[model samples]
Target chain A: MDIVIYGTVNSIVFALIAVGFTLVYGVSRIPNFAHGSIYVLVGFLTWSFVNDLRMNYALAILLSLTIAAVVGFIMYRFILIRLRGMATSEIIASFAVSLVILEGLRMQGIGGFKGFIGPFYVLRPFIEGKMNIWGVFVDFQRLIIIGGGIAVVGLLWLFTHHTKMGLSLRAIAQDERAAMMLGVNSDRTAMISLSIGSALAGLAAVIILPLGSVTAEAGYKVLIYALAVSIIGGLGSWAGAVLASFVIGFAMKISTAMFGAVWESVVLVGTIILILLFKPSGLLGKQKELEERV
Target chain B: MSMLEVSSLMVFYENALAINNVDLRCQKGEITGVFGANSAGKSTLMYTISGIILDIEKKERMRGGERVTVLGSIYYEGADIIFMETSDRAKKGIILCPERRRIFPESSVLENLKIGGILATRAQAKKTLDYVFTMFSPLKGLKKREGGFLSGGEQQMLAIGRALMAQPKLLLLDEPLLGLSPMMEEILVRAIEDINETTGITILISEQYARPILPIIHHGYVLENGVSVLEGTSQELMDNPDVKSAYFGI
Candidate 1:
């Protein structure tokens, strides 16, 4: 039961990280490999602010989100915009940016080191007690993670579905040139989407900080898992990503329990390949229609 | 007064000239037709006038007298607006219904129309949408359907309806009758004429087929290899010996 709750919490948090990656790719049609770097950078920045500078946890979290948003905006304006018509170059650029960011952090004495910043006081009480349900003892921390994940997902859905900006985004994602011709500003839309996605990732990172120590390279595993979930769910569909996340999260947990942590990634990778082979359009992706549109 | 004036307009692809020393004019409330064979630079001229092909890199190669051109310069209740972004140009009553019926395929027909009316206020958009629905009543049932699912004729109607929602002073229709059956072509031609008659919007249509379009247009130009070889009233062009031998193949 404990393992099950842990798996659920891990999956939800990981899904949020994946959502950011998926949203940017969906709208821009560029595989943003640098997204993983952004996640790790935010985690490290939050840690440095709270532990190194001894700042308040709230203030650190705020600063972390702000930094992530600014960086995302800058990357879009400087890097992505220049490579707009060249998609392959844009993907390569993102990969290059990820390397620069990761290496820069390492050179600055922030890499190859594990740092645990805070068992944030506000969240400490949640993990203090455990509840027994159906012969399984569920930690309050795990419950909070799961509940918070659902709330965030619901809010994201509302924003994407109900808002005018969200509607514009969907239109742009469908046909960028047509959207531009229709007066939808692609740059502003992309910037806003990237910021929102990165902020959500920052929030998830802050939430998960208490569960484990964070390293400079801590985001790679989560990145891989999230990408796998996204591909399995469908490239641009939010509903697919969420459902895939749960499947991946649970599957990983069960596999880890049965096998070991070493073989867990292999199983996840195999499952993704199988899904891709069978359902190339993904679970929720519109197969024939969108391809023709593109 | 002429609504648009172009003189000695030259366009190039890489190093080769595509449109060489092209000059043309369109008067207010007139439907001008540009007839050309494949690769005759008709589309290139339209793209150049619409500012889709910028002179950023090609400025050095451009050379001609009276090269200065004015687009959307006609006084519409006292306003000059030739230099505007495509969307801004659209808002100020200069809309282009591009070739291939460039509809937002993934979007619903209603959404596509709404996007076309993006520059207008919400109430204005609503009113314009209603006007579009009235103009293309066949589109009323397909409002919720995605643009990709619509038949070619329906998509063409939706494309024209979308341009109408912009409330244009001049609408550019690039090959509206392309890829349509004879019946569909007739329907589209009638729709185009009806829109012009009812709204008083000036139109410039580019086409490869001259027979169907010549009857509807007031003036026409025969373009061969990017240069205008013949310019006359539609009836004169239709009756001209050279036009008959070269274009009409009659």
Candidate 2:
């Protein structure tokens, strides 16, 4: 019962982190390498708003997510727009932007040698309560993550299927040129994709960050985890990303329970390598490059 | 005014001319056929008219690959629209049903039609969608089917229906009958005729086979090696022995 409950929570967290990256890749074929930095930036932004400015938690969360969306929009419109269609340049440019944002925040740390942020830099959870179910106890935040994550995925599916703009975005994902012929503007679609992707990253940050303290280094760890799930599931495959999250989520939780905390990363990295060696396209991926050569 | 006019249009991919000083016109409420064999620039001309060539040229240049040059003048509704962006061109009622029926593979038939209806107002989309269903009845039962799994003829029908959903004043059908059986070809030809006659939407259809398309087209241009070798009405082309043997497999 414990493994089932915690493993589900782990899987939800992983899916939330990876969904943003997979979406941008699916629509525009550009891996937004700045995903983790955006994730951490939102955590920090909300933290400062709530702690330093002494704002309401709900207000701060709203402000941080909106800012993240705008930041994503600007990143695509100004920088990534010119670099479109060149995957290598896109990766490099996003990585550079991410590094600058993260390192710039670190430099804002209190003094010279010591960083400004420490484990003490944390955001209070929204509910501020705990729940127990069937002989296992978990916080309200964990329950929200589980429930909220599934809701997000379901809502996204409905949006893409039933809404005009969402349908256009999916059209752009499938065939950019065809969409263009049908009057779907590529630039506008890509910009919107970036905006939504950024907001999603921020949303995940807000939901998951309360479980742990915010740190500059956490950005790197988040990026690695997101990338690991994406690669293991198959890049740009949405359903694959969700399903792979569950796989890795359970694996990591079981490993931690069996060996120790140190074995978690080892298992994560090991799973990625094994997947790459055997099925590089991932479990649910139908990416163009991974199309069978024969 | 003609629905579309092209004059002195030439396209080049690094000195290899794909289209050479070609001029074509599709009258309002008429069907025009451009018949050509492989590498005869049928697809290129279609792309150029739909303004997709501009995009292709830009992408190639950005990637430091082939340098594409397009020299052309296209007049629509008595105005020069030679250098417009593709989506803008589409918004102006010039929609292209691309070669190989480039349907969105992952989307279902209904979703694909909705995407194609991006340019229209809600009412127009609804009207056009209903009209499409009536015209291509095969698509009615396959609303939930993904495009990737559709047969070639079914995809062609979906492609045409999708373009119609955009509420086009002029539709460019590129290789609509490609890889279809004889019966499928007949169905599409009749459907294309019906669409043009009933709706009065100007159509510019390109095909490799002249036999199936020749009778329906009011005007036809026979292209060879990127050059228009013969231009005549249907009856005149039927009387031309060279065209009969070359294109009609006489």
| Pairs of residues at least 3 apart in sequence or in different chains that clash in candidate 1 | none
Model 2, A1-294: lDDT tens digits are 889999999999999999988888889988999999999899999988888889999999999999999999999999999999999999999999899878977774456433345578888887888788998998999999999899988988898888888988899998999999999889999999999999999999999999989888888888888888888888888999999999999999999999989999899989888878888788887754446764
Docking class of 2: high
Error of 1 at A151 (Å): 4.6
* Per-candidate RMSD, Å: 5.6, 2.0
Number of the top candidate by DockQ? 2
Q: For residues A1-294, could you state the per-residue lDDT of candidate 1 as single tens digits?
A: 756777787679767778887888788776777777777777778777876688887788899999988888888889887666456887789778877766666663365554433443222223467788678877676677778788888887776655667766776787665555555666778888777777777777776755666655666666676678778888877778888888878888888898989988787887788887988877777743367569
DockQ, all models? 0.25, 0.87
Any runs in candidate 1 off by more than 4 Å, and if so which? A1-11, A48-60, A106-164, A237-239, A279-294, B54-94, B166-169, B242-250
Residue B45 alpha-carbon offset, candidate 2, angstroms? 0.4
lDDT for every model?
Answer: 0.74, 0.91
Cα deviation at B88, candidate 1, in Å, is 5.5
Each prediction's TM-score versus the true structure: 0.81, 0.97
